[model samples]
Target: MQLHDSMIKEIEKSKDKIIENRRLIHQYPEVGWTEIKTAALVARELESLGFKVSKGDVVISSKARMGVPNQYILDQHYAETLALGYSEAELQPFKDGFTGVVGEMKFGEGPTIALRFDMDAIGLEESLSTGRGPVDKGFVSQIKGQMHGCGHDGHTAIGLGVAESIAKVRHQLNKGSIKLIFQPAEEGVRGAKSMVEAGVLQGVDYVLACHIMANEPFGKLICGANGFMATAKMDVRFKGKAAHAGATPNEGNHAILAACSAVLNLHAIPRHSAGETRINVGTIVAGTDRNVIPDEARLKIETRGANTAINAYVKDYAYQVIKHAGLMHQVETEIEVVGEAVGGKSDEQLIDIIGSVAKRLNVFDEIVASDDHAGGSEDFTYMMSAVQAQGGKAAFFMVGASPDGTGGIGHHTSNFDFKEDALVESIKLFTGIVLSLL
Candidate 1:
């Protein structure tokens, strides 16, 4: 209890700094794989606190990364970050879009614990309404079409706070090591797999991660997350010969027709009796001119299920439909998988630890073990799986962010924002959990 109280004091002292950092990150939002500046900031803060820091390809495997932007896009982000006054030395490690940071500390030989934090913003314009949180607070996103619609900015701040608090109380901890994983590109569920492949969870004995839920009431904490659906994001393209629609329509193979057919058939995929299932064709693009038969078409699609096997069942059936759709239209079909994640359940041991700590803090008004329904996909499942594979226990927890105890704005919307005070509670909870384990 003495050690926990000490950690709480450290977190309380840094409350103002944590809120400032969250607002600062909210101002200059960056999207997945393009978070060069964000990664640098996290790395610098960890270094200042005396943690061994690693960045770039060393923290994330280049070959294993999926849905990465092309070189041109990555170069533009690098240039933009360089112009923002970050030294070439600080920005060089993340030059080619490999952006993530890992801060490590060694104590002796006990349990190795890791905490994961994601750093990326959603692509959305911010609302300029006067009463909106960001607008009223004067920290609205500066970049157009990029905003911290999700609470990752707050998560990053909490992670840094935990690092600072841990450094201050290292002597009171058990003989173990701590790792702070600042990940990128989690919005598309694309980053965690790469980090896991690069050996992030190699020797981990326990791993814990938390997300800020905008809908839940503030001071409410969920000990573990469940019903995470496994999912896959894919890009489908069709190629055909073009010709004048009015003159030689028969000579042209219609790629647009194939894409349309594929969309219909993809949705027609039967649901698995095993559990829930979902499929959506989010975007479709085809044709240059209306007078010409379109020669190319592209689609952005995704599939989800209650678990990995069920997700694969739907994905495989969708593939068959895509192939047949192309054949029906005499067009060539191409498919690329960009992102994927498997469903996972939190370990009961970790859940109990978090629950006990939350009770000790006496801050949370409510504590739940897990969600009732299957929630959306999270790449963190990959990290959880990796640790569990090596006999380590893992759990994904949730902290409420609703300011007025009413569900705030929903995530991924332009008006999305959360209670600033929630940041302090989150830091305290995370810090307490880490100290208890160490």
Candidate 2:
């Protein structure tokens, strides 16, 4: 699909503005459902540009929300962004404290197309060392402990840029609808399904979403990285009695001990011979003082499998381990599923469309015509699966951009970041595909 020369010029004009928007978002990184400032900015911009926009819980199913922060936390974040400049009216839709945006426009009657961009940051303390951190670049996140280590800020900016390019040519667009989905809580794989539950995929015909530099170099692009792994995120809590350690150690039941046991047993689970699988206890909290036995312990554990059956196998084993660990320590335990996603595959037909479009753009160092699915998981799978369930075609791509030449740093860590230039390529690539489809 060749983007008309005029259409190419339209996208070319938005390049600088796109990079600027990316930096603005990078400076204020918000995590998951707490994206008040981000969502508001997205909604306001799309609304001003003349698209019908939907915001907040209306885009999510409350009953399906999982692992949400407590109300106090949600309210605190909401207040913070409100103070940053968003008005109460702009925030009214977020009354019950959820955040996301969907901007849709039907330009004459073609197939309905959706672009998904995640709007969330990770819980990692960004680097501050001289010349080695985002802070040194002046666009550092103002919030102390949060960071946009994942290139999502770039993703959001690109989505907005793509929308603008598409809008400029609306007069020529015929026979199709376009939807821009600025999603939240993607870090934990928790937002997409709710939107799916909210009927966001109804009548949709094509879907495409991308993630930045999983390892590919700054100029390389993976037309389709097969698909990501199936995954399940769980929160476990163990309850026990607390007592002074020196006075009577036996009188106290240690919940931390139970958590430790579970963490070890979780890692000890046999690997799946069928395919790649992974289990990790990412965070653990328990105990106040070293002299006292902790009464409560909590764990943020996750499991991943290359496919549905393998993921199910690992999830079942993980649960058994959690249950038995509690029994071994004689403590009551509770478990809650925070999020889940089944493994997925890109539609080959759609992949070819994207590859052809990307080639004509004359950008990207390498275009991976095809590749194997990932060992990690992504909630975008939920949206893609939903679209496919209704006979629609879907594709997920990898936008490679690495500054140090090591493929952007580790995704969920403190040093993670990709070249902002990826945003430019993304805006061009995504818009090109939309033009071809429309």
Query: What does candidate 1's lDDT look like per residue over 76-108, in tens digits?
Result: 989988997989999999988789899999988
Model 2 Cα displacement at 37 (Å)? Answer: 0.5
Question: Lowest summed lDDT over 10 consecutive residues: which window, candidate 1?
Answer: 1-10
User: What tens digits encode model 2's per-residue C-alpha lDDT throughout 1-438?
Assistant: 347777777777777888788888888888888888888889988998889999888888898777688989988887876786778999878655478799999987669999999999988888766654365677887788999988899889988988898778777776789999999899888989888998888999999899887456888888886748999999999999999899998998889999999999999999989899999999998988999989899999999999878999999998899888898888889999998888889999989988999899888878887778566788999988999999999999998888676674678777776777788788889988998887
TM-score of each: 0.98, 0.93
Model 1 misplacement above 4 A: 1-3
Best by TM-score: 1
